[model samples]
Target: MSVQRSWVIGAADCYNKNNVGLLIRKTACTLKPDVIISVDGDIIKIRSESTFKNHDTIFKLNEEFDEVTADGRKTKTTVTLDDGVLVQHQKWNGKESKINREAKDDQMVTTCIIGDIKAVRIFTKKN
Candidate 1:
């Protein structure tokens, strides 16, 4: 039998913003190749490899508001990528935000914000 390498990646409530009490914990694991696979959870995955030369990853967040807007107008926001790419703009249909990228060390420290609230998704290129 052949052995397979797997990584158990997870975070504790210690890192969660809502778990101030540290009572709630979340965890997950996956093989390196499975990085391209999507999972049903709030977690984001990043992978690195020689053949690929770079890693691509995305994170999404969705939230619903009591009202679409204070003035009853649809709220919209634009997102800019590290490459100076204006990926997309969002309008109030139950706000969904996403961050995507082709990994590069310099891009790791780069970021974008939606309105006044900073996005929680972060991708770092591996050296």
Candidate 2:
């Protein structure tokens, strides 16, 4: 049998909320301001981050499209910041085009794979 291994990195936090006349509860979780890296037969990576204060452009490409069979609301297919550019493809019969300056630097981070998997290793360090 083959086992799959994955790694996720991100910022997390714990929070406590109290309602009036109610007991307080505490919860802990990781926030999205972090990055997630996954490895499979191939490799996939995901990154989530806050917006950058400075101005910058990011690229995106359309990946998938979903529509209601009855209404046909027609939603555009989009990929989130594939590179430094944003590309929007029309749904169904729409044309494929690119949009410049669609993503601000503050909105997202870059994500990509290194190369084919030859070996895998992991280590942890304390700060």
Candidate 3:
């Protein structure tokens, strides 16, 4: 399938842990970033607002690619699509994080998990 779509920030939520046994502060709603996604065959390209640094990426499905994080950490990333969701994993410095994204009707939801932190970012289709 090949299609291109633009999404505007709708909302965000975060859940985190301060330490192994400590809960993070209350959910913080921050960083509303616009996004555009294009898919062609097994390749996908993503572009995000500058407010979200290091989010723009292009990769072929099921292949590991080199990527640097917004914080400047070099990581190996691999992306795959399962059912209707895009699942991404990034590994670096002996740690790993995951992001799951799904789009339906007019909205897209992304769930990100790292250590004890989890965040959900929502976006509405831009006309």
Candidate 4:
């Protein structure tokens, strides 16, 4: 979407944190985080605020990059968008995770999956 949008957590489900890694665990615990997304051409920037810290990531579409997660783990990250859906893939330490985000009305719904453990976070778009 070529525009900056602010989003706030409207709902989340992250109960079984033990099934995932530290990064996902922290996210599971931070149920009500805030996020701001800026999309400009092929580049997308995402800034998120959690209970403990604020994280910012900037990446171009379909490009793979190295990302050190908030839990201090180094991971390879790639982001792509297709058919109005944004997908992110992460790999590290022989583990992998996928995240999908799509806009439904005025809300951005994100589904995070690591193995069979899935966490859903819904954010309401603002302004």
Candidate 5:
């Protein structure tokens, strides 16, 4: 069996609630940010592994979506697809900065596989 991997992008520790909200809003079709988080790009790897030296955008998972309260807590999170498939988060270890195979669901869900990540002051879509 092959292993799934995902790159760690902007975590809650790096970006504020507003920036995170923008990403979610851009991808959210009709669901509220409270119910869904969006992933962008193509899948070249699994969801449990990290795309080291890659440009893939990865979102850190947490127990809740409350930006005010859900800060710095490593917990089981869920992955949402554009088609409405909720890949529930299982478990992960944040101490070693390693990907946890236990956190990914068994179903195959296609989402954005981040490649290069650029850290800028303004986190928004420029036109």
Candidate 6:
């Protein structure tokens, strides 16, 4: 079977961000690519010192999130999550999500406690 293309698209300083770096490294390790390619500058230097692989292909990014051709043609690219079936997030009629109904069920519990405390105060009559 042919391998699918897994491109890590990000800004020039994406490597500087901890979350972004971890994400890229995690993807690389998970995919286990023979050679890691960096279209940005610092990422290549950073990944080269990593445990994954010393082999790397460094290609400069012509723009922030665009690639230009030899004929000076600019094509815009974007990274996005896989789309799937939409599920209902909010409750119908503005109800809360997964509330503990048991708490509301025990409404009389607080009343009983307050009654007991009042009874004790009445008997003790401490000024």
Instruction: Give the top-scoring candidate (TM-score).
Output: 4
Candidate 6 weakest ten by summed lDDT: 118-127
Cα deviation of 90, candidate 6, in Å: 33
TM-score attained by model 6: 0.15
Candidate 5 or 3, higher TM-score: 3
Candidate 4 Cα lDDT to native? 0.80
2 or 3, which is superior by TM-score?
3
| Candidate 1 local lDDT, 18-67, one digit each (tens) | 31133321221111222232334753333333232334333332332222
Question: How well does model 2 score by local distance difference test?
Answer: 0.27
Superior candidate under TM-score, 4 versus 6: 4
TM-score for each predicted model, relative to the true structure: 0.25, 0.21, 0.79, 0.85, 0.18, 0.15
Ranking by TM-score: 4, 3, 1, 2, 5, 6
* TM-score: model 1 vs. ground truth: 0.25
What's the residue-level lDDT of 45 in candidate 4?
86
Runs of candidate 5 exceeding 4 Å displacement: 1-70, 82-125
Q: Give one digit per residue, the lDDT tens place, for model 2 in 1-127.
A: 0111222222222222212122211211222233222233432222223232111112222345442211233445454333444233334444232222222222321222112211111211112
Superposed by TM-score, candidate 5 places the C-alpha of residue 40 at a distance from the truth, in angstroms, of 7.8
Steric overlap count per candidate: 0, 15, 0, 0, 16, 0
- Whichever of 1 and 2 has more lDDT, that candidate is 1
Using lDDT, give the best candidate's number.
4
How far is each candidate from the true structure, as Cα RMSD in Å?
A: 13.3, 16.3, 4.2, 2.6, 15.0, 27.4
- Residue runs of model 6 more than 4 Å from their true location after superposition: 1-64, 69-72, 83-127
Worst 10 residues of 2 by lDDT: 117-126
lDDT, residue 74, model 4? 84
lDDT of 1 at 122: 31
TM-score of 3: 0.79
Candidate 3: tens digits of C-alpha lDDT, residues 3-109:
25888878877545422222213313445667888877877988777453437789998999998755456899998888878888999879999988888778888
Location of the lowest summed lDDT over 10 successive residues in candidate 4: 15-24
